[model samples]
Target: MPVLLYVLAVAVFAQGTSEFVLAGLVPGISADLGVSLAEAGYLTSGFAVGMVVGAPLTAAVGRRLAPRWTLSACLAVFVLAHVSGALTDSFGVLLGTRFVAALANAGFLAVALSTATRVVPAGRRARALSVLLGGTTLALIAGVPAGALLGELWGWRSALWAIAGLSAAALVAVGRLTPPRTSTDHPGSARPRLDLRAELRTLRSPDLLRHLGLGALVNGATFCAFTYLAVTVTDGAGLVPSLVPLVLALFGLGAFAGVSVAGRLADTRGRLLLDVAGPALLAGWIAWAALADSPAAVWVLAPVQGALSFAVGSTLIARSMAAAQGAPTMGGAFSTVALNLGALLGPVLGGASLGTAGTAGPLIVSTALVAVAVGLRLVTARRRSGAPAR
Candidate 1:
């Protein structure tokens, strides 16, 4: 694997940490900013909205730029946004900064995934992609927890400052490691036609659409449950408030394990089954979690559910990239959008479920959604195999 892959991975790690660490720091931020907890929660929502808007927009704009340069520019934007977020006094300004930061993050991820696959040998491409993507999972496992600890000790602003520093390191690494852009065409050739129409045509395939839909559904369901997981563990399970961050950290650790295992399994066994099976298992785990009343059960079940849900990341991403044919960037961008959509909807749904059906309703709905995703995957897989061989 190229050393550049590792550099890009660092960039991803920084972005992931910045995006998710907020969850652990929400209460601190609310207290420091003099905002209500509900308002502080909008930071997560703002980031999600930015990701959804940025993916396609960045892809469209960066079509003409070299992939390396595009990535570098995105990282620069990310760093600036983080700095702004760290320094801002007003809550509204902080939210705007976070949203822009998320936009840069989404674009960086989409471009980085495309570049990783392109740089590696075809035989090792999936593994290469896994290595790059694993950085984000690692951040979830380690970075968020550490940030929470820092927030508790110093303040939430300190956590944001730390993220900004990390982003700076990532920017420098990316600039040094990535190679100059090379054209797919003849030397000094005019840029190839981007063909937005052709790209849209790719989405018209029934199999591709089904895969995308499955991606969206699985993510939406998973996020819905996960967004409010910390709250559930604290409020419903009756765990001490101080322990919530540690539990969330453990969840991140489970996610890291899940992502690593899932990547290898998808590369070897095929992604479709892994996609369905991971979510199905996650649903069962969530149900178990819902039924448990003890603190021990909460600890055990949270990690289990985290493992099952996150394990499917690589599989789902690889599936979308494969189904996209040659347009890996657009496919990746769309997948990012799906993920953000899930992030946006998950907390809202979970909160509503908590209000309406009490603690168990969200998990029950999540289980049903995962089951539906599994059925959809089965039908899609059979249809693909039954079709004329490509």
Candidate 2:
């Protein structure tokens, strides 16, 4: 992999940490802002909404700019947003700042993925994309936990300041390491004309939309279990409250590990990886729901589910990019859009399941969602093989 791709991952790490660390700081924020916990939860939802709106809009706008410059501008905005968020007194101001930060984050990721595809060879594109996305998974594993500790030690504002500082460093590294904007285009040509109507047309494929839908289903199911994983571990698995964070970290570690393995497989054996992981995800969820009462089984199930889910995600991303080969930026942006849409729906469904069907209900919902994805994948395979549709 190119060294600059890793630098892009660092930038992603800063943004990913900023986006997710809020989960751990909700209590601190609610206490400080004098808002109810439910109200403070809007901050998270607001970020997801921003990502959904920002992805395509940013892709369209950034299409006119050089990829590195677009990435740089987004990182600058991200840093400033955090600085403002850290200093804001009003909850509304903080929420607005988060929305702005998410816009920049969405732009950064979309450009970064598109740029990685351009710089790497055809065969290694998926691996390159995976290395860039690995930063987000690593943030889930390490950054969120550390931010939670910092929030406990010095308050939530401290976490925002730390994120801003890291973003600034990433901004500097991006400027130093990434190739110039002109390098992304032809040897001596102006930035390509960004025809909005033409670009939008590229994303209108039924097949592409189906795959994107599959991605949303996969993400939604994972988050359905994850949204209430803490409760499930404590009440269902009989683990102590103190062990919850450890188990959640285990899930993140599983995601990081899975992404790493999937990154390699995507480059060399993508079809085989997809074939195995989709069914494995359904099986993992089945075991999770069936063995919810066993602490040991829960420990094993949590990471397996996480790994299989993320491995499937990496493959889908690569597929989406390939499917939208005519407009790479839009393709990359759509992946972000799909994942955020899933994030938004997952919590709602999970909360409902928890309220009505008890702790294991979310697990069952997740299993069913992954099963849908499995069925879709099989249909895609059959279509490719010229076999009759089921």
Candidate 3:
């Protein structure tokens, strides 16, 4: 991997922190802003909404600019938005800032992923991509916890200030490290360009649609359980409030491990890895739903579930890009969009299930989603292997 890959990861870390730190700060924000917990929760969903909208919009708009310039500009916006979020007095202002910040974040991630694929050798694409995406897992492990600690010590606003500082540093690094446009990674290729019609045309492809759906389902399965993990662990598993952080850390560790394994298998064993991972994910969720009442069972199961959950990131993105045909940047954008869509949908569906079926409801719903995804993959694999479609 190139040094620039790690720099991009740093940018992702800052953005990912801003995206999720709200998870731990909802209570603080609610108290400080004189809002209900549900209102504070909208800060997170608002970011997801921005991500879903901004990915394709930014990809279309920025396609004409050089990747370095586009990425730097996005980071600048990200930094400004974070600072604004820190200084805002009203909950509405904070929500608006989060939305703008997510727009920048989505743009940055799309451009970064496309550039990562361009910079590395074809054989190392998966590893390079993993290195770039690893920032999200690392943020989950370190950034969120750190932000929570900062909020506890100071105030919720302090967390935003810290993220702004981090984003500023990433901006400087991006400006210094990203490659120039003149050295376009694809030899003999035209400058990046996309129009609304072109984007619409690309979306018409069934294969791309399938890949996007797969990405969405894969992510939805993970997040359905994850969105309500803190509540589930406390209420269903009988853990104390203090133990919540431990379970979260365990999940993060598991995600990091999953990304590590994905980097190794994505290139050589894409199908096989998913073949195994998809079912493992289903099994893990089923186990969680069945045994959630047992704290001992949850202690052993959470990390394994977390690990299997994210095992598809690199492979899924690569597959989606393959289906993209000519529009690689848009492909990357759609990948982000699909994941955000799942993130948004997961909580809604999980919340509904919880209301109907109690604490284990989310786990069961997540399991069903993954099972459908796995079934899709099985059918696709069979078709590729010359087996008749049933």
Candidate 4:
């Protein structure tokens, strides 16, 4: 793998830590700001909203710039946003900073994934992409736990400061390590006939839509359960407050392992079977978690859930890149945007269920969504086979 993969992975790790650290520190943030837990939840929702809007917006703005420069600039912005988040005392300012940070983050990941594919040999593309995305797992394994510990010791603000420092390190790494620009017209070259109409035309392909729907379903179910993991572990499973981050770290380790294995599987076998199986497995695991009240059970299940939930990232992403035909960048961006959309909706659905039905509701609802998704995948497969030949 190219050394740049490690560089981009570092940037991604920083971004992922910033994104998820808030969950572990939610109680601290709520207490510090004198806000309710529900309101503090905006931190997660705000970031998702930013990614949803920012992914395409930033991609469009950076279209003319070199991918390397675009990535570096985004990391710099991420550093600034984390600093701003660390310094802000007001809830509104902290939320706004997170949003800004997410904008940069969205652009960084989208461009980095596309560029990773471009820099590697065709056969090694999936592995390169997996290594790049594995940074998120690393963040969960290391950064989030560290941030949570920092929050527990120094305060949530201090945790944000640590994240800022990581972002700064990533900015420097990307600046020094990202390869030089090879084409000003590279984006155009990838999609010479690109336009809103042309993009929409591609969407009309039922096969492509099926694959995208699978991606969304898998992600949505995963995020729904994941968003409230801290709450579930603390309240539902009766774990102590201090141990949540440690469990989360364990979950992250599982995700890292899952992504590694899934990447090779996707490259060797097709993604469709993995797509179908992953969500099914996740649903079962989450259901088991909901019923098991033992802390030991929770500990064992956390990693199992994480592994199953994240197993699809590389496969789904590579599938989308392939489905995009020649427009890898646009395809990469769209796939990410779809994933963000899932993140956005997942929490809302989970939160609503939690409100209406209490602790077990979210997992039950998540399981239902995954089952529906599996059925959709079957229907989608049948439809693809029955469609008139291109």
Give the top-scoring candidate (lDDT). Answer: 2
On the 0 to 100 scale, the lDDT of residue 37 in model 2 is 98
TM for every model, in the order presented, reads 0.90, 0.94, 0.95, 0.89
Give the clash total for candidate 2: 0
Candidate 4, 210-249: lDDT as tens digits: 6667677767877777777877778888889888777877
Q: How many Å off is the CA of 299 in candidate 3?
A: 1.9
- In candidate 1, what are the lDDT values of residues 54-125, reduced to their tens digit? 888887688677777888899899888878877888999999998999889999887777777667655555
Residue 386, candidate 3: Cα error in Å is 3.1
Error of 2 at 79 (Å): 0.9
For model 2, residues 1-390, the per-residue Cα lDDT tens digits are 889889899888878888888988999999999999999999998898998988888888878776778888999999999999999899999999989999999888887877888787788888888899899888888888888899999999999999999889989988887777544432354456546676568778866787688889999998889878888899988899999889888898889888888888887787788778888889899888888778998789878877888898878888777777666567778888888888888878888888787888889889888888889867776777785321
- Model 1 misplaced stretches (Cα beyond 4 Å): 182-194, 271-276, 279-283, 294-296, 382-390
lDDT of 3 by residue, 211-289 (tens): 7888898788778887788878999988998998888888878888888888878888877887778787888888888
**Candidate 1 lowest-lDDT run of ten:** 182-191
Against the reference, the lDDT scores of all candidates come to 0.74, 0.84, 0.83, 0.76
Off by over 4 Å in 4: 182-201, 272-276, 279-283, 286-290, 294-297, 386-390
lDDT of 1: 0.74
Off by over 4 Å in 2: 182-194, 383-390
lDDT of 4 at 361: 62
| Counted clashes in each candidate structure | 1, 0, 0, 0
